[model samples]
Target: MPKGVYLRRAGRFAWLAFAGALLATPVYAQKRTATPQKAVQQQPAALTIPSDPDDAFVALREAARKNDADRAAAISATLVDYPIPSYVEYFRIKSQMFDSSGQPLIDTPDAEISAFLQRYQGEAIADRMRNDWLLVLGKKRDWANFDVQYPQFVLKDDTQVECYALLSRALKGQNVAADARAMLVDPRYYGDGCVDLISYMAQSQQIQRGDVAFQARQALEQNYTTLAGKIAAALPDARVDGDSLATVVKMARNDPSQAAAYMGTISGNLSRDEQGAAWGVIGQFAAKKLMPEAAGYYRRQMDLGGNQWLSDESQEWRVRAALRQGDWKQVRQSIESMRPELRAKDPAWTYWYARALKADGRGSDAQQQFQSIAGQFNFYGQLASEELGNRITIPTRTTVSDAEAMAMRSRAGFTRAKKFYDLNLRFEGNREWNWELRGMNDRDLLAAAEYARKIELLDRTVNTSDRTKAEHDFTQRFPMPYRDIMQRATDDVGLDMAWAYGLIRQESRFIMNARSSAGAHGLMQVMPATAKYVARKIGMTDFSPSMMGDPNINIMLGTNYMSMVLTDLDSSWTLASAGYNAGPGRPKAWRTSLSRPVEGAIFAETIPFTETRNYVKNVLSNATYYAALMSGRPQSLKDRLGMVAPSAVTTTSLP
Candidate 1:
């Protein structure tokens, strides 16, 4: 979800007035529906042999919307002789993905599917069509087709396709045990396909008796108690009954250690694995609470062998609590016990490990670790650079030659992506651009991004630049496209331009027309109601809905409100960011219990709303990076965070 997405949801009903008080909204190409498509009335009996392409296109969409496949197909047939836009092709493909009866349209000729893919090679809708086609193929047990198409699946984030791939592999007598373990741990992604894969693996001896309990522990640690119970029920050798699991869960809710002690009552009867799993779940409860006794609770159970999942989580939160209490020694010990593979990738734990090393008089070793992760982008990565006694620095920009730029621009995918942008179809444009970069090396990616910059596609340029790993181009990464507008907004509101930039980057990735699913509008994702209120408050004349996506209007209104919240929260950017995201009411309530000033970092970690906590971190961290880019000097994240103090009571909900 985009930042402030939920905030704008309720305000979507606000009337959007176009030019001269005309209430109009653009109609988007939605996914196919089950209802039958409806045809338009004939233009005139004699005049209408067939409407022109544009007129035919409108009728086609209506037919598609009505789920009248036959009529839509007829209209789409007329489009064959006309020069239709890419979206017309998209609707044609979508209508074929699913029929009006709500069943996936399988048995379509493979040649036709292949032809569509070839025609829309670089379009976002192409991948969507291919995904649906692959699903149909997989269902029909056409392994040869599935195998050929699976590799071309650019965004392989689809768990069902992954599961189907595994199934295909297993049927071909391939070993997918390692892949299954990595992919199946998260219950959230499980669907009909993944579940079937799991069931097949279980029956095939790939899932052992021990693996069952391990999965149960994995489920429990993630707070999916029902999934955990299901795992336990399925395990043939489990000693613990359903009733005991319930009793233990209730106990764990109060104090994790208490739950651990209760496990002792059945210690003699339960297996070692069961004991470990129960203890692991208990530790999760304790670590999450960050109770004073959390460290001891995990420390005493260090030798327990349980689900590898729970062990990792238990250690992570133990370190989190230890860090909060300034217990460097315990933090080091907890991280040291973590799996090497997990520890190697986690920057947070690595940073803490370096801190522990420094505290223990091993500055040389700490510096070595810090040096490896420095210059990277992310919360912990920046912190690591600070520990190594260096500040964030922008990378030198590379010039793109005319020949190289032409070569990049000539690519079919990039051209299609650019076309989408020009048509104001940003969503489709972004998808197409991202898909085209799937196989490009870092240098190629940089070149493509430079080409995007040359074309003034600032949003795509920024996003494309983010894909580079071997190179860092801060100019492209933290672009200041609407510099003049932002300057005025910040200057008038007396707020930090870098901070505003940071918020906008996270809010909409600098897309001028970005609209979230929750109905947030424009670059800053301002709610309609909030925009209206701010418009009136600032005494702006002729405020209208047509101005939502206008970069100047959005930045001015957003920055002004930012200043308002900053002042309301006693100049705390941390709280202001949270207020901006989750609303000012929650932050005010969250601050009421602050008996004394607390570190912004600690308060952020403890924020009950996961989205707001993450939003605050991202905004502040981004601001830090932007500050480095703008000032050409190091900036302190600590100074930016400052200390958050309790708020004074105010009559108004939002300032």
Candidate 2:
């Protein structure tokens, strides 16, 4: 969310008027004339200096507010004489004076801003400065100046690849292209820029047909070698040739399968040091399930330099391989050699580690670990808790019964009957009644139809425009079956129905068997382990992994897991939501560290994860609409959700 700037008009006027009234009133006629006269006789008429910087700042702010340029300038000059950084003061002066209409002011000229930015070229603030400079450049049409500053601004390691493409388009000259190509090939751009450059080229149609294969081959070559080297170097007690190994590791990650294949071709070419690195690559690839062939390579690396890092990597792969093969002993030995840091960071590792400990007859230790993680209000936490015999309890709403819900659905119809009826009555032949209806998506339409239908059933007159919109929305993409499934899941888990819909929309677009690149499966994108636990808890025996793809099974398990998370998070829906998106433990950690009130917007804005932040918003917004529609309220989605200021509307309650 963006910050708001408010001008205290009444306060400013009151102070100014009070000062004027005081001057206009005669001292002789005032009741305190004698005291004032005595004070005038006793005191010197010199100006008093304030002891605090805050006072000085306040005076400056007042002067600026009054548009007293001379006083403001004097204050600025005086402040500049002090040793403190004047950036804030400079910003304030610029913000106040540039626009009488209260719009934000950009004080520096395009060229000057670019020059100022160059001084802090590689600093952390460079990105912000560069963005501001770009805006200025665009506004002022300083293409020539922009072309010059572009390369310098992009030298910062953190510069986004998008910046390069923007620069390329802005500076499409032959000379600029050559320079950009040089930058692309530089070792400094090898990090994220390599893939970014490829993507940019692909989007811009800059890469010719012949260059595609060549570029892909080059990427394959560099990444595979770099990945292999990093693994080798990170191995225990192995003398890494150089930083080239780390580079390869990152490169290999970009295209794991290709990198794994490249390892075979480069095998004979690798020196003893290089060979160890190659084995490391194989281990990483196998860990990602990218290339199982890398297993042999990892073993070979272990054979060459049986050090801790290699041993650790080897063991990690062994665990994965064992899990795939269901070899319990290999899983145990592999997990044993794993570093404590890996075990702590990865929930899967912790779960498996506990499993290994349990299988080895260390039940007490295993139970403790499992208990600590179980009852966590997230997928993994819920799984852990379920395994420890903590059953999740879902809360129920008493307002709507199953019969009523079924009746509402029946009225809404499988097609557009409910929508058409609602709209026809809402409009009542009044064509002019309309609303902007901002943020009205398909789900909103469904809610609106539901809301309108309830109103019409009560014989209330609704605006024609709103009714038309509701009907149009409902008929366009009902998502009724999907909505029904989600509602059921939410009800079953005692989760927010709207939030469930939102999650489904985001994760799978209401597709029953959606699978993400990260291996999150089904409507709620439940992980395999989470699904497995949920199935077991529900007394589902002989549950195939493929069962997770079935909507009914997925929703049952996902909702049950959601209920577990809600329980573990102490019934705080906000934390539960966060736990749902980002594992339960992280939200718990975040809550402890940042302790802000868990209001939807505040909590969402403060979320460190961008993905999770947006996820929360979409879910909450979805929930608001769902509640209003399902509950038969004719309230705006934002109003019901407490989004718009309460004072914006006359009534507080949903209609």
Candidate 3:
């Protein structure tokens, strides 16, 4: 095609494609044309500007993301009549406020930001802008204005903001040490807020010296050497050496035993808390490596300085090490030592603690623990239910009246969210939608999910329905779109349809054109290399990576690949699910490391990679629920997992 003709066709195609997405039953039901098109296509006949307002809006957003204030303003000027004007205005204003790295541009007046917030009050974008401005105000130490705006910032999800908020409180002579310790668990997001908080807290003597050492341990564990050094400098005695901390972190990565040995040599010169922190780091690395000595290292840490200085994450690692070593006593003790609130937050810890109780012959106590988590719908929840002799079943489906569903169509948030979704701006769309879901009752959630389904926002439909506490619509939550295509694909490969659906639900939430950060694409999140490999295996001579965007082609290739992994892993769902996620080699190597047959749940929990461990558990749990929904029979997650035995002969390679 000629350049002029191609551009016109692309512009028209982009609008028509978005239009089809709005009206289609499932957004991906409409197939794309063979050729790829640019998001912001311009027709030659329309001078240098984009032919469509939405295309110009897309360009404005790209400019804003780059913090190109001039370009954003120029493009946004052409989008005066754009369908989503709030976002267009938001980008124009935001571009002027922050540089490309998201640092606030110096001398940007706070009045301009407050004006936007005042105009768009109670909207998601306004709340988001408040979050941005609070960071700026916090950095500038403009606590007077920050104090006024902090409570109005609705989401409060940003950790750095929380840090700054705590810092502001501490400045007012309030004790915020406990709050800082709780919120500063993750150093990756510490930024200026957390780093400043720690410094101020230490200088004021509000937090104990042990707290500073713990912060250093957390930073070193995350490989934040500079942050760790800063934390060490906050200690009054300067007893914890920054260079020694760096050496221990490096040694832990390569060899946990070496890290332990180095810690042992330095133990006498260090404070008890520092000694414990060093030992905790070694234990965490060793636990991740599945080393049997991990439990002993944790015990040594506890023996030296008690568990008072250990972070919640370090305490969790202590439990994991015990679970790996099958040391029930250590598991029980470590869990009991955790802060009550932290221990109760994660059901995985509860489940393991219950298992330890049962292993220690405290059956009634274990039963009580199991009952606490049993009727829930997550991975640990299902496992707890099976332990209580119950199978997973679909909750009774809830109904939404037509009037109730119709009401969502008039909601301002939903309307804006739909507009963003139509423009393919999912981040903004999700924020708008989720912000509306706060404090909603079960019936309201069901109605909102119904509205989502009617609008072909199937992912939103699933997520919205999944939030209901007392009522549910299983059909809405586990939406089966393109059933005929999915059915045929699974049948052709002799794959279990429910299992395929389960994996797809976890993989992409049925978003047909979904693409992961690692470059996995389509409904199945098939990697490009894996798609080609499956294409060849299944005799798809004309297959290309672009073809993977098709729901039919993607599902077929994904299910075929699923079948291959299952066959390679001896048809174990647990192993195959892990293999599908982390790769065949990892699960294979994990299985070989097992000394004897263990329950599949143990194998999943013991998996070293956090992503793969959670993926396997969720895939199996989803498969159980999908099976129950399809078969109209209570399904056993335990039976589905079965036993994962040691296998010396395991596949080490696959696409």
lDDT (10s digit) by residue, model 2, range 502-591? 456556545454577778897678888778877888788988778887887788777888778767766655666677888777556555
Task: Give the per-residue Cα lDDT of candidate 1 at 361.
Answer: 97
> Which is better, 1 or 2, measured by TM-score?
1
Worst 10 residues of 1 by lDDT: 18-27
**Model 1 TM-score on a 0 to 1 scale:** 0.77
Per-residue alpha-carbon lDDT of candidate 1 for residues 149-214, written as tens digits (9 for 90 to 100): 999887677877898799778655566878887777566665445544554455455666556556
Model 3 stretches with alpha carbons more than 4 Å out: 1-51, 233-242
Using TM-score, give the best candidate's number.
3
Model 2 alpha-carbon drift over 4 Å, by segment: 1-478, 482-490, 595-598, 634-655
TM-scores of the candidates in the order shown: 0.77, 0.31, 0.90
Tell me the RMSD of model 2 versus the true structure.
27.2
Task: Provide the global lDDT of candidate 1 against the true structure.
Answer: 0.69
Regarding lDDT, does 1 or 3 come out ahead? 3
> Going through the candidates in order, what is the number of backbone clashes in each?
6, 11, 0
Model 2 / residue 216 / CA error / Å: 23
